[model samples]
Structures are given as structure tokens and as C-alpha cells.
Target: MPAARLPVYDAGPPCVSRAVDAFVRMGMAGVTFGAFMGSYDAVKEGYKGTGRALFVAKSAARNSLGWGMFGGAYMGLNCGLEALRRKRDWVNASAAGAITGAMVASTRSRSGIRVFGTAALFSSIATASEYLRPVQYPPTGL
Candidate 1:
């Protein structure tokens, strides 16, 4: 006799999967923002100019550059994860943001610590919102 065909469960529907995936992406978003902030701070401190003009220019340039770099890095990391891990990208991106931001916060004075901590808190909330109200996409069994 032929082997019996096995039943395939739908893995709890696309909605559930998508919701979980969004939550994961939301986590990544927080990390990415944090990492970005941390990196920005590190970049700022790397400068060694004591002159006012050079210092001012370096600070401004560092801020702008950091923002751009962090944005790119966050997207790239999350996209790469999505492609490779076959998971939701937003959560991964949010996590990356948080990590980067925290790292940036770690490399600062006490005042900076307070500031970054506050930023992290707010960013986390924002990320959570992203997860709950995710940007829709075709479900991918994530």
C-alpha cells in the first residue's frame, strides 16, 4: 500500500507569524538606534583638535556623518539578516539600533549617559509601536 499522506499544519496562520515577526523586527530596531548613537559618540571623541574652529567643524561633521552612517548600517544589517535568516527585518533592525545606541551611550560622560539612556527609553517605545503596528508585507513564513 502507498504511504499515507501526512497533514501539514499552517504554523498558526500568517497573521500570527507576521505579528511575531514584527515584534522581532521591533527589537532589532532598538538595537540599531542604540548602536548608532554609541558609534556617533565614539567618532566625536576620536578627534584631537583643541582649536575652536576645528573642534566645531569636527563636531558638526561627526554628527551628520554619524546619522547617515548609522541609518545605512541599520538598514544593511537588518536586510542582510532578513535575507539570510529568513526572518522579519524590522525587529532585527530595531535591535541593531538599540545596540548601537547603547554602545554610543556607554562611551560618554555621566551627562551623556543620562542623555543616551533617555534616548534609548524613547526609542524602545517607538520600536515597540513599530512592532504592534508593523508595516505590512507579504507573509514569508517567518
Candidate 2:
């Protein structure tokens, strides 16, 4: 027979640590994406420029910085929501994602449609991911 009660897992209080860790991890992904996209851009130019290599490097660095900033912002919002709501669940992730998406899009254009579109896109992605994530079970007493 199943137990009548379920054990709770204490992940500790919400702190800056989770945000910082997430930022670094996502930042690395940004770096990788930057490297590849930059290379592709350079290659599309038919390697005709004397500064092709330098162009690739600059593009990579710039893209990486942009993505890294996005990651930090997204995670910071997530962590803040988690702390404020006193819950660690998909609601937080979805909200954070929507806000972050809107913020990022607004940087380029202040159009309502653009911001709202991105917000919806991001929130959906976050919610889907949260739902797809595996359930975390409490540790065994043994």
C-alpha cells in the first residue's frame, strides 16, 4: 500500500545563487550560439574580405554578450518571482519568460504587437517546458 503522506523536499530559500548559476550556464550557451552564427555569417560572404576572421570574431562577441544579458535578465526575473510568490512552479517560469521576452523585444521596437507577440511566445515555451520537466520525488529515508 502507498503511504498516506508525502515527504517534502527542502530546496532552501530563494537566493542570488540560483540566478547567478543560471546566468553562467545560459551565458555559455549564448557563447556557443554566437560562435556558430558568426561563422555562418562570415561563410555566407564567400570569404572575400581581408578582415573576414576579425569580422567573425566581433560578431560572435557581440551576439554572445547580447544573449548572455538576456539569460541574466530572464533568470533574475524568475528568481524574483519565485521568492515573491513563495512557490517554485511553472507559474513563476511562465511569468518570468513573458516579462523577459517583452523587455527584450522592447529594446528594439516599442510596438505593442511585437512585445505582446514575443511575450506570448516566451510564456508558452516556458509553460511547456515546465510541464514537460520530470517530477522531483523526495529523497528516500533509507
Candidate 3:
């Protein structure tokens, strides 16, 4: 007599984990971009001595932090919403952007503009980006 074996399954990493990945990737990108821009501007200003590096570093640091927060929040909310609804679509992206925008707006000044300005702006940007993205189809055999 032979014993039957049960198959094991492997689920992917958690949403937050993926969100952290996004944060790092986006943050690094932001740091690089800010550094480049700052260096260019600083050089253009022709400020000799140690102040040049200081200005570049400041810009890079600021951008790194801001982008990291934006990426983490946006991806986290998007992933959470997708998991909750069990669907993959732009609605989740839009809602996530709006949520992220609201958070940013709240943290910054202008409480009144939180929902209307920032949230709406982000939601619109997300909607446009999602719409512009190429559609993905599943493999038939999978």
C-alpha cells in the first residue's frame, strides 16, 4: 500500500513587504534625480568651495525622504485595497493616490487643501498613468 502526498503551496510576499521594496526603489531614484539637479544648479551658480557639496547633499537628502514616504504610502494603500477587494484595477490606484495625497497634504500646511487639492491631484495623476499603462493578460494554461 502507498501513502498519498499532499501538495504544498507558496504564496508571494506580503503587501507591505512589496510596498517597502517600492519605497526603496523610488527613494533611490529620487535621491539620484535630486542630486543631479542640485549639482547642476549649484555648479551653474558658480559657488566655489565646500558649499557646493552641501547644497547637493541637502537636496538629495530631502528628495530621498519625500519620495520614500510617497512610494511607501502609495504602494501600501494600493496593495491593501487590492488585497481587500481581491481585484487588480485602476480604482485601487486612484484611491491609493488620493489617500497618499491626503496624508502628504495633512503633514504639510493647508488642511483645507488636503482632500480637494492634493488628493484630487494625485487621484487624477494616478488615473491617467493607470489608463496609459499597457494592459496585461494572463496566460491561458496558467
Clashes of each: 39, 0, 0
lDDT of 3 by residue, 1-142 (tens): 8544323222234777868987898899889988999899899998667999998998898989889989888878887886677666999989998988888887886668555699999998987877875453211234
Q: Rank the candidates by lDDT, best first.
A: 3, 2, 1
* Candidate 3 TM-score, C-alpha based: 0.76
Clashing pairs in 3: none
Clashing pairs in 2: none
**Once superposed on the true structure, which residue ranges of model 2 sit more than 4 Å away at CA?**
1-9, 46-50, 134-142
**Candidate 2: lDDT of 68?**
74
TM-score of each: 0.39, 0.79, 0.76
The alpha-carbon lDDT assigned to residue 28 of candidate 2 equals 76
Query: Compared with the true structure, what per-residue lDDT tens digits does model 1 show for residues 56-105?
Result: 54445555555554455444554455445556545665665566566445
**Predicted structure with the largest TM-score when compared to the true one:** 2
- In candidate 3, which residue ranges exceed 4 Å CA deviation? 1-12, 41-46, 133-142
For candidate 2, lDDT tens digit of each residue in 77-122?
8778866776779998899999989998899899999999999998
Q: How much does each candidate deviate from the true structure in C-alpha RMSD?
A: 11.8, 6.1, 6.7
Worst 10-residue stretch by lDDT in candidate 1?
5-14
